[model samples]
Target: MTTSAELLAAYDRQLRTDAETPSALDVEQLGPLRLVTFDGGRGFITYAGLDGADAGTIAGWVAGALGYFRNNPAIRHIEWKSRGHDWAPGLHVALVGNGFEPEESESIMIGRAADLAVDVPLPVGVALRQVTEEEDVRAMSAMADGVFGDPVSTATADSLLRRLSHADGMELWVAECGAEIVSAGRLEPVTGTDFAGIWGGATLQAWRGRGIYRALTAARARSALAMGKTLIHSDSTPYSRPILERSGFVKVSTTTPYIWRAPA
Candidate 1:
């Protein structure tokens, strides 16, 4: 059994390499900031967990990354993801000075995959499985959008379509009540690494407290174990943090996303 620290260490080691990017708009280095391109008209910036930097350097990085995005008309917005454990100086001020606004912060949770594999009770008739078909993938993405309080986005659906084509051991799992998806998440078994990322977990408000999310998490864990992954990590919202803690995941740090929205 891998400890949470060991699990997180493995994740950090792999994320900087194999898990960093998969497309043109993924993760790019512009001086100090890690520039990322998402499916929509958005770009993003994150660091490799830098511990500390002076205010001047931090400010320069923010300005430089913003300049890069401004030069590219393809990017309409950017999000700077900051880790709570990082000791970088003046990050908050720098982001704001350059027009980035802080959004809600989330807990960075990590744990051993086996910890979540314990048998969990599920609502009768609810089942889970990996999705591959285009229509089903689109439906799941739409359900997730609804759960996340975002409007339906064709870009998300299109990206999922492309992701399925590559396969690459990435699998989308959903908890279905009858024919409707009540909860959905993704399993990313990073190649040549001992970690698998459990991402985008969203359960409908009405479905809360029913253990559907845990069951879905377990299903992903079981799959990860089969694929030789020993660890699981997620940047969790407050709503999901307690549930994950009960299931043995520990809060290692917090992450705050700062956004620069293009003028509408």
Candidate 2:
């Protein structure tokens, strides 16, 4: 039996670097932090467990990470992705004291691909499929943004399109009801690892409880299994965590994203 500690250990070892920054154009290292510059002026800050760093050392890293990104004029939006199980107890104060606002925390869900690959009955009139065309990709992004209450992001769609063009093992799946996308998610197979992640899962309010999202998850899991991935991972919101939990996924940890936006 795989324990939560072991699962989190694998995640911290295998997923904290390249697996976390697939779209990064440049990455700067500040102490233990990886300050990443992605396309479209987005910056991201993350790291593996802080190890044994004390509050003062952790505080210095926080300040240095901010300065590293703010110096780049193209960096308009920054996010510090913090894990719940890390030993950096002073991260919250250091980040908030430095003007970063914390977003809602999400559970770090980990499970076996076979557990979630089992058949899940979809609702009548709903069909799931992988999308690659520009029109379909754009529509899926729009529906997911609306479901998550975020402004529609064309940059996200563009990134996905670029990945598809590169033949990157990233799959976007959507559940459609009469030509309208009601639920959507992404499956990314990490090269050289046993893990493939299901990310950005969302469902329309009216479509909730109809099994569309669960069916979409199973479809993604089946796709992951076909890609030779035996493990599944996700950072899922509360709305989606229960569904994943029901399918035998366990919460290995939690993650909270603290965000900073440049002033107009």
Candidate 3:
């Protein structure tokens, strides 16, 4: 059994680069930050750590990072990805002062793919399948956004469609109850690494506690194994943390996304 510390170390070393941003349109470096631009006018900020920088230095970095995106007219939204274990000083205050809002934090869960590949029975009248078509992808994205209380956004669906067109080993899985999607998630196999990420896991409120998510996770784990991935990772919300923990995943760390939107 790999400990949480070991798993987190491995995650930082192997899964934090282009593997994490396969769809990035451009990536620029600002000191320790990887300033990435995605297709939907989105900017992302991520870094391994602050390298023992002081609060004043980190504040300067924050201002410079915001300036980098502010100069780009096409960029409307920016997300600064922060880890609980990082050595960032005064980062939260800086982000908040710069008009960034903190979203919910999630547990960074990791475990062997084989440990999560067990057989989980789906609910009666429910079926699971990989979705690709535009309609199905839209339906999946809508269900996911609704479950998370986000307004329906076509940009998300459009991005997923673009990724699907590339056939980049990213699989979208959905558990359907009759004609409606009850649960949905994505399986992203990292190129040049032994890991696969299970992201965007969402289950309809009424469908909770019925093993549909576990079954969906198992299905994805099986798919990851087929792709020759040995490790599985996820930034799991409170709703799905226990389920993954029960399935042999350990909480390696925590992650929070601070979001900033350009002034209208």
Q: Among these predicted structures, which one has the highest TM-score?
A: 3
Candidate 2 residue runs with Cα over 4 Å from true position: none
| Residue pairs of candidate 1 with colliding backbone atoms | 25-37
| lDDT, model 3, position 89 | 84
| Model 1: per-residue Cα lDDT over 135-195, one tens digit each | 8899899999999889998899898788777766778999998999999999888777677
Lowest summed lDDT window (length 10), candidate 2: 15-24
Compute the lDDT of residue 92 as modeled in candidate 2.
90
Clashes of 2: 0
Q: Which segments of model 3 are wrong by more than 4 Å?
A: none
Look at candidate 3 and tell me the lDDT of residue 12: 94
lDDT of each: 0.81, 0.90, 0.93
Choose 2 or 3, whichever is better by lDDT: 3
- Backbone clashes per model, in order? 1, 0, 0
Model 3 misses residue 226 by how many Å?
Answer: 0.4
At residue 122, what lDDT does model 1 achieve?
89
Instruction: Arrange candidates by TM-score, descending.
Output: 3, 2, 1
TM-score of each: 0.91, 0.96, 0.98
